[model samples]
Every structure is written in C-alpha cells, then in structure tokens.
Target: MEISDLERIARDIRRRDIQAVYEAGAGHVGGEMSVIDLLAALYFHVLRIWPDQPKHPDRDRFVLSKGHTACALYVVLAERGFIPEDEISTFLQPYSRLNGHPNCNKVPGVETNTGPLGHGLPVAVGMAKAAKLSSANYHTYVITGDGEMQEGSNWEAIMAAAQFKLDNLTLIIDHNRFQQGASLSETNDVAPFRPKLEAFGWEVTEINGNAMAEIVPALEHRGGRPHCIVAHTNKGHGISFMQDRVDWHHKVPSKEQYELALAELSEAL
Candidate 1:
C-alpha cells in the first residue's frame, strides 16, 4: 500500500482507538496512540498472514509486547479482517474477549498472550528460533514499551536472540518516553538504546514512530543480525492536549475532550 494510504488507515485506527477507550471508560490511551502507526504498518503493509487461517504455518508472526495498547491492535485487526469491526464496541465489557491485554488464544492474529511487562520479547525469540530450527521462511516481530525495557527479562531475551543468531527477528521499542506513572527518564532511563543493542550483537535503526514513511522502510529492511528499531514517538500523539502527558496514559477522556480529539483525528483522516 502507498504511504499515504497507510497514513490514512493509521488515522482511522487512531479514531477508532480513541472511541473505544472513550466508550470503555478505561484504556491505556496514550500508549495506544503512540503505537498505532506501528501496528498499522505491520498488519496492513508488512505482515504476511491469512485472516481466515490465523494459525497458518508459514505466516509471519507479530506480538504486541506492550499489550496495554491492545485497543489499537484490536482496531487494526478489525480493519485487516481478522475480526469483526463491530466487536470493537464491546471492548472492556464484561465477558468481552477484547480485554485490556491481548490473548493469543482468543484473538485471531495475536501470537501469544501479553500484558505483564518484559514477556513478549522472550516469546518472540522462541518463535524466531523455532522458525530457524524448522527451516521456515517466516519472520517474527515484537514491540515493547520503553518503560518495559527496565525489566531484566528483556535484556536476557536480547542476549538469547543474539546468541541464537536469530536474524529473522525484529524488535521495536515504542520509545514514547512515558510509562504508567511517570516519564521513562524519571523512572528507568533506558535512553541511548542503540549502543546497548549494538553491543548485544543486534543492528539498530531509529525512526519517528508516528511517520508512516519511516515506519514502513524500517520494518521492511532485512539484515544478518537481529534488528531493533528504537521508534521515538509521542504519548497521546494525535490529540493536542493529551500529547506527551503521562496522566493520559490510561485516563478516560471527558466528553468535551473526546469531541476535540475526535475532531483532530477526523481531520487527519
């Protein structure tokens, strides 16, 4: 798809994500906004999978490691035909399969359940290693929050991926700079991610996570080593007042705020 089309789809995903959070009265909206473009680029343009056959052996694997942003992933899955778009409205409702975090068994496209911090990368490493062992051509991708990087498990997974020489693995850190309670700088400063990753034997690329032009090419690039994309993005990216505000991390938008945010996203669409 054209970059323009991908941008439009990303905007639409943002719009739906905001609405879902507003309706659900609960969600990690800031992280959701920050990460939507990456999800759009992956599901719409980069991933090779069948919505009808979600478990197809040769399909590319994607794991949303920062699963608090599942609302955005849900919208992308709906847009990409993996699930019913109407099902999005049921988000956060009692008994709804679309919970705050993704569940691989319940969701068609999700490769594994993820919500607890620092788990996705290890699972993705396993998948990539398995593909290598089986001589499968499929590649594996996982996205992690910058705050989530503070967990020691991610570092361990980085070591394992490098040791295994899992060249087919791609890890994207949603470097939005904010976590649940405070900014990443205030909490665990994992900035200067490139050198740390390179030292671990991985190739690193940095890009504006919100820009479709940058996102597509970075995701498409192949290499001999495991790749890490440090995607610098803004928390609550599209909406004006919410942008970069840590409180918006999971706060439900007020009626007026919702209208204004919807207007901004609509204009982008």
Candidate 2:
C-alpha cells in the first residue's frame, strides 16, 4: 500500500479507537493513538498475513507487548479484515473478544495474549526460536512501550535473542516519552535505547514512529542479528489536547472532548 493510503487507514483507526473508548467508557486512548501508525505500517506494508488463513504456517508474527494499547491493535485488525469492523463497538463489554487487552485465543489476528508489561518480547523470542528450530522462514515482531522496557523480563529475552542469534526477530519500542503516571525521563529513564540494545547485540534503528515512510523500512530491515526499532512517538498522535498529556492515559473523553477528537480524526481522512 502507498504511504498515503496507510496514513488514511491510520486516521480511520484513530476514529474507531476514540469511538470504542467513548462507548466502552474506558480505554488507553492516549497510547492507542501513539501506536496506530506503527500498527498500520506493519499490517498494511510489512506483515504477510492471510485474513482468512490466520494460522497459515508461513505467516509472519506480531505481538503487542504493551497490551494496554490493544484497542489500537483491534482497530487495525478489523480494518485489515481479520475481524468485523463493527465489533469495535463491543470493546470491553462482557464476553466481547475485543476487550481492553488482547486475547490471542479469541482474536483471530492476535498472536499472543498480552496485557502485563514485559511479556510480549519473551513470547516473540520463543516464536523466533521455534521458527529457527524448524528452519521456517517466517519473521517475528513485537512492540512494547518505553516504560514497558523497564521490566526485567525484556532484558532476559534480549539476552536470549542474541544468544540464540535470532535474526528473524524484530522488537519495536513505542517510545512515546510518557507512561501512565509520568514522563519516562521523570520516572525511570530508558532513553539512549539504541546503545543499550546494541550492547545486547541487537541492531537498533531509531525512527519517527508515526511516520509511515520511516516505519515501513524499519519493519522490513534485515540483518545478521536481532533488530530493535526504537520508535519515537507521541502519546496522542493525531488529535489535539490529548497529545503528550499524561492525564489522558486512560481517561475517557467527555462528550465535548469526544466530538473534537472525532472531528480531528475525521479531518485526517
């Protein structure tokens, strides 16, 4: 898909994300907005997925480690035809597959159930290892929040990925600066991510996470070792007032705020 097309899809995803959160009365809309562009680039430009054959052996894999942002993933999956787009309205409702966090078993496009911090990388490493063991050509990708990287488990997986030389694995850190409570620098700074990842023997690429042109190449880049893409992004990318505000982490928009957000998103389309 063209970059313009992906941009349009991202805007649509943002609109759905806002609507879902507004209807569900709660969601991580801030982070969802930050990561939608990256998700759009992957699903539309990089991932070799079959909507009807989600379990196809040769398909690439993706794990959303920062699972609080699952609303964004659900929107992307629905737009990609992995699920009915209308089901987005059911987010967080009782028995709805489109819950606050992703459930791989229930969601057709989700590869692993993730909500807690630091889980996606480990699972993605295992998937890459399995592919290596079987000599499969599929690639594995995982996205985690900048704050999520503070978890010790991610380091363990980083060590293991290098030890196993899993070149097919790619880890993208959604470095949106702000965490739920405060800015990453104010809490536990995980900046200078490239050096740390490089020290662990992974090739690191830093890019503007919300830019489709930059995102596509990073996702598709190949190397002799595990790759890490530190995607610098904004918490609320497309909408005004919400962008970079820590308070919006999980705040449901008021009626007036919702209308403004919807207008902003629709304008991008």
Candidate 3:
C-alpha cells in the first residue's frame, strides 16, 4: 500500500479504537493511538501472510508486546481480514474474544498472547530462532512500549537475540515517552535507546513511529544482526486533546470527548 493509503487506514483504525474503547468503557487508548500507524504500516505493507492461512509456515509473525493496546490491534487485524470487522464492536463485552489483551490462540492474526510487558520480544526471539533452526525463511517482528523496556526480560532477550545471531528478528519500540502513571523520564528514563541497543550489538534505526514512510522502511530493512527500530512516537498521535496526555492511558472518554476524538481522527482520513 502507498504511504497515503496506509495513513488513511491508520486514521480509520484510530477511529475504531476510540469507538471500541468508548463502548467497552475501558482501554489503553493512549498507547493504542501511539502504535496504530506502525501497525498499519506492518499489516498493510510489510507483513507477509495470508489472512486465510494465518499459520502458513512461511508467514512473517507479529507480536504486540504492549497488548493492553489490543483494541488497536483488533482493528488492524479486522481491517486486514484476519477476523470479521463487525467482531470489533464486541470488544471487552462478556464472552468476547476481543479481551483487553490479545490471545493468539483465539485471534487468527495474533502470533502470541501478550499483555504483560517484556514477554513479546522473548517470544519473538523464539520465533526467529525456530525459523533459523528449521530454515523456514520467515521473519518475526515485535513491538513494545518504551516504558516496558525496564523489564529485565527484554534485556535478557536482547542479549540472546544478539548472541544467537537472529538477523531475522526485528524489535520496534514504541517510544512514546510515557507509561501508565508517569513519563518514561520520570519512571525509568531509558532514552538514548539507539546507543544502548547498538551497544548490545543490534543495528538501530530511530524514526517517527507514526509516519508511514518511516515505519515501512525501518520494518523492511535487512542487516547482518538483529534489528531494533526505536520509534519515537507520541502517546496519543492523531487526536489533539489526547496527545501526550497521561490521563488517557485507560480513561474512557465522555460522550462529548468521544465526539471530538472521532471528528479529529476522521478528519485525518
């Protein structure tokens, strides 16, 4: 898809994310907004898989480590035909498969069940290792919140990915600079991610995560080592009021707020 087309899809996803969260009365709206563009670029442009054959052995894999933002992912998956688009309205309802976190077993496009921070990269590493061991010729991509980088497990996986030389693995950090409670600077301050990741022996590319032009190339870039893209993104990208506001982390918008957010997202389309 062209960058403009991907941006349009991202706007649609953002609108759906707002609607789903407003209806569900809860969701990680801020982070969801931050990562939608990246998701759109991947699902619409870079990812290699048939929605009908999600388990195709040659298919590329995507693991959303910041799974609290699953509503955004659900919108992307539905848009990509991995699941029925109407199913998105059932998000977080009773017995709904679209829970607050993604469950790979139930969701066709989801490659792993992820909600806990720091889990997706390790699983992505495993996926890459599997492909390497079996010579499957498929790539694996995983995205995590920048705040989630504080988790010890991510560092462990970082070491392992480099140690094992899994060039097929790609890690995209949604560096929106905020966690649930505080800014990343106040919480743990893991900025300057490029140097840290490069020191760990991975090639690093930093980009505006919300830009389709930047996201697609960073995802498609090939190197001799595991690749890490430090996507410097805004917490709430498209909407004016929500952008970089910490309170919107999981706050359900009021009816008026919802209307304004919807308009903002739709205008971008």
Candidate 4:
C-alpha cells in the first residue's frame, strides 16, 4: 500500500484507540498512541498475514511485548480485517473479548497472550528458532517498550537470538522516552540502544517511529543476523496537548480532552 494510505490508517487507528480509551475510562493511551504508527506499518505494510487464516502455519509471527497497549493492536487487527471493527466498542466491558490485553485464542490476529513485561521477545525468539528447526521460511517479529527492556529476561532472549543466528527475527523497541510513571532516563535508562544491540551481534536501525517515510523502510529491512529497530517516538504522539506528558501514560481523557484529540486526529485525515 502507499505510504499516504498507511499514514491515514495510522491516524484512524489512533482516533479509534482514543475513543476506546475514553469510553472504557481506562487504558495506557500514551503508549498506544506512541506505538500505533509502528503497529500500522507492520500490520498494513509489512506483515505476511492472512486475516481469514490467523493460524496459518507458514505465516509470519508478530508479538506485542508491551501488551498494555493492546487496544492499539486491536484497532489495527480490526482494520486489517482480522476481526469485526465494531467489536472495538466492547473494549474493557464485562465478558468482552476485547479486554485490556490481547488474547491469542479470543483474538484472531494475536499470536500469543501477552501482558506481563518481557515475555514476548523470548517467545518470539523461540518462534523464530522453531522455524529454523522446521526449515520453514516464516519470520518472527516482536515489539517491546524501552521501559520493558529493563527486564533481565529480554537480555537473555537477546543473547539467545544472536547465538542462534536467527536472522528471521526482528525486534522493535518503542523508544517513547516515558514509561508508566516517569521518563525512562529517570528510571532505568535504556537509551543508546543501537550500540548495545550491535554489540550483541544484531543489526540495528534508528528511525523516527511516528514518521511513515522512515518507519516502512526500517521495518522492511533484512540482514543475516537478528535485527533491532530503535524507534524514537513521543509518548502521546497524535494528540497535541498529551504529547510527551508522563501523566497521560495511562490517564483517561476527560470529555473535553477526548473531543479535542478526536478533532485533531480527524483533521489530519
């Protein structure tokens, strides 16, 4: 698809995510907004997925390690035709499949259930390694928040991916600066991600995560070793007032705030 179309779809996803958070009265909206562009690029432009055959054995795998932002993933999945788009309204409702986190069984496009920090990368590594063992060509991709990188498990998985030489695996870090409570620098700074990833024997690319021009090329890159994309993005990207604000990490938008955000996103379309 064209980059312009991808950008429009991303803005639409952001608008839907904002609406869901406003209606549900709870969500990690800041992270959702930050990561939606990457998700949009992946699902719409890069992933080799079958919306009608979510369990196809040879299909590429994608795992959202920073699963708190599953609302954004759900919106993208629905837009990609993996599920009914109207189901987004059931977000966070009682007995609703559209819960705060993505569930693989209940959600057609989700690969595995992920909510706990640091688990998705390990699982993705395994998935890639499994393909290698099975002599399959499917690639595996995983996205992790920079904050979540502080977890020791991710490092272990990183080391394993390199040692296994799983070139089919790709990891994208949503380097949005702020986490749930404070800036990543104020907590456990994982900045300067490129050198670290390269030192671990994986190729690394840095890009403006919210920019479609840079995002599509980076995500499409392939190399002989595991790849890492350090995607620098703002915490609340699409909405003007919320951008870079740490408090919006999981804060529910007031009615006025929601209207303003919706207007801003719609106008961008």
For candidate 4, lDDT tens digit of each residue in 179-229?
A: 989999999897889999888999999999999999999999998999999
Error of 2 at 198 (Å): 0.6
Worst 10 residues of 3 by lDDT: 260-269
Off by over 4 Å in 3: none
lDDT of 3: 0.93
TM-scores of the candidates in the order shown: 0.99, 0.98, 0.99, 0.99
Candidate 1 on 37-139: residue-level lDDT in tens?
A: 9999999899999999999999999999999899999999999999999999999999999999999889898899999999999999999999999999999
lDDT of 1 at 96: 93
RMSD of each: 0.6, 0.8, 0.7, 0.7
Give every collision pair in model 1: none
> Each prediction's Cα lDDT score?
0.95, 0.93, 0.93, 0.94
Is candidate 1 or 2 superior in TM-score? Answer: 1
Most lDDT-accurate candidate:
1
Residue 12, candidate 4: how far off, in angstroms?
A: 0.7
Q: Candidate 2 — number of clashing residue pairs?
A: 0
- Model 2 RMSD in angstroms: 0.8
Error of 1 at 264 (Å): 0.9
* Candidate 1 residue runs with Cα over 4 Å from true position: none
Ten-residue region with minimum lDDT total, candidate 1: 260-269
